[model samples]
Target: MAYGQGLADRVRTLAPDRVTTATDLFGTETAETALALGVPPERISTIAAGPNPPGGVRGTGGEQARPADLERITDAILAGEITVPIAATFPIEQIREAVTLQAGRHVHGKIVVTL
Candidate 1:
């Protein structure tokens, strides 16, 4: 299947009533959509840098990072922490369960289904 930006689009459509006042660490492109809907730059966190940090978030590194890592290790671009993107927390073979977790069906983290 061809890749598309539909996922972002879906996020845009979430709670249309809040379209004019949604706020979070949505990306620049997503933030642009918010601006189009009357949101502000300061209200958003634009992490165009792939290895950069997300808003309100501390690091983007995987499981290898820790608080001590930042205090003890080299200041060499401290690994950024990233919340697990949906399916990573689950097995793909069990897609239905994943969808259930995403459909607001369960108390879970913000999730996404990726290929």
Candidate 2:
């Protein structure tokens, strides 16, 4: 999963079997990058926004997370089927540090800012 081109490039270098991008700016460039990385066209999925949308792309206003979905995910995490890495944690007073780390775009996991 990649949020932007920079991360996408990094992911591509790893030659993943599939690439999923949650970027509103997904376009030809992103697709090309994936292709160059040897990811099959059908294996690349992207999320885009707008009324017209891109050709051959279906638009879903986006899915809302139901309580059951959240519960299932939580259960998976608790069962060790899913793992969420925490890159760093900061107290609320150090929110700036957390934000800075997040903005650096090099984080491989979630950054938690605690209350």
| Residue pairs in candidate 1 whose N, alpha carbon or C atoms collide under 3 angstroms | 59-80, 59-81, 60-80, 60-81, 61-80, 61-81
Ten residues in a row with the worst lDDT in model 1?
A: 53-62
Best by TM-score: 2
Q: Please list the residue runs of candidate 1 whose C-alpha ends up more than 4 Å from where it truly belongs after superposition.
A: 1-13, 20-27, 49-85, 90-115
lDDT values for all models: 0.46, 0.61
Q: Which residue pairs show backbone clashes in model 2?
A: none
Evaluate residue 96 in candidate 2 and report its C-alpha lDDT on the 0 to 100 scale: 88
Compared with the true structure, what per-residue lDDT tens digits does model 2 show for residues 51-109?
54333333443375476887897898999977788889999999988999998877878
Report the C-alpha lDDT of model 1 over 21-109, residue by residue, as the tens digit: 33334334454555555555455544342454333322223366687875653443345433233334555667787777666634434
lDDT, model 1, position 61: 31
What clash count does candidate 2 reach? 0
